[model samples]
Target: MTDEIKVPDAGTADKAKLTVAILVVIAGVAGYYVLAGRPAWLRWTPVAGSLALAALVLAFSRYGREFRQFVELARVELRKIVWPNRQETGMTTLVVFIFVVVAGIFFWLLDLGLAWATKLITGQGS
Candidate 1:
C-alpha cells in the first residue's frame, strides 16, 4: 500500500491562533481598564509596549510562517466567492422590503384581532 500524506502545518497554525487570541484578550482587558479610569500614564504606554512585543514575537515565530499560509488559503477562498452585482443587489433589497412589509401587515392584523377579541370578552370596547 502507498503511504498516506498528511498536512503537517496544523499544529503550528493552532499555536499561532492561540497566541493571537491571548494577545487580543490581553489588549481588550487593558483597554477596558484604561476606559474604567486607570491613570493614562499607567495605561497606554504599557499597552502599546505589550502590543509591540506581541507583534515582534509573532513575526519571529515558526507559527508566523504557518499564519502566512493560512492567510494565503483565506485569500484563495475569498477569490472563489460570488458577490452580488448592482442589479442583483437592488433586486435582493426589493425582496427584503416586500418581506418586511408583509410581516408588518401580518403582525398588525394579529394585534388588531387580539384587541378585538379582548374587547368582546370583557365588554370594554376601546
Candidate 2:
C-alpha cells in the first residue's frame, strides 16, 4: 500500500556495462603506470581515453539512462526552487549568530553555577 518508487533491477546487459566501465577505469590507471618512461601527456592520454570510453559504455546501460533522467528531473526541480535573496540570507544569518552567542553565554553561566555548587558540597573551595 506504500507509495514507494521502486528502482528496477539491472539486467545482465546493464551489469556487463557496469563491469566494463570499472575495468576501463582500472586499465586507464594501469596504463598511466605502464607508460612511466613516456611523456606526461602520453601517460595521461590512456587514462583520460579509458575514462571517456567507460562513460560512453555506461551511458548506454539501463542504470545510465535512469541516471540521465534523474539528472534532467533534478534540473527541472532546481528551477522550481525559490531561493532566498541576499537580504533575507543576511538577516537569517544574523539571527543565528545572535542565538549562538546567547546559548554560549547561558552555557558558561550554567557551568560556573555547577562548579560553585560542586565545590560547596565537597567543602573544597573557600
- Best TM-score among the predictions, by candidate number: 2
List model 1 lDDT by residue over 23-122, tens digit each: 8659855775766666776667656766676766675566667788999999999999999999999999999999999999999999999999999999
After the best TM-score superposition of candidate 2, give how far the Cα of residue 25 lies from its true spot, in angstroms.
2.8
Candidate 2 lDDT over residue span 1-126, tens digit each: 789998779999889999999999999999999999999999999999999999999999997788899999999999999999999999999999999999999999999999999999999997
Q: Superpose all Cα atoms of candidate 1 onto the true structure and report the RMSD in Å to 1 decimal.
A: 5.7
- Model 2, 80: alpha-carbon shift in Å? 1.1
Clashes of each: 0, 0
Per-model TM-score, in order, reads 0.63, 0.73
List candidate 1 segments past 4 Å from native.
1-42
Predictions in order: lDDT? 0.78, 0.96
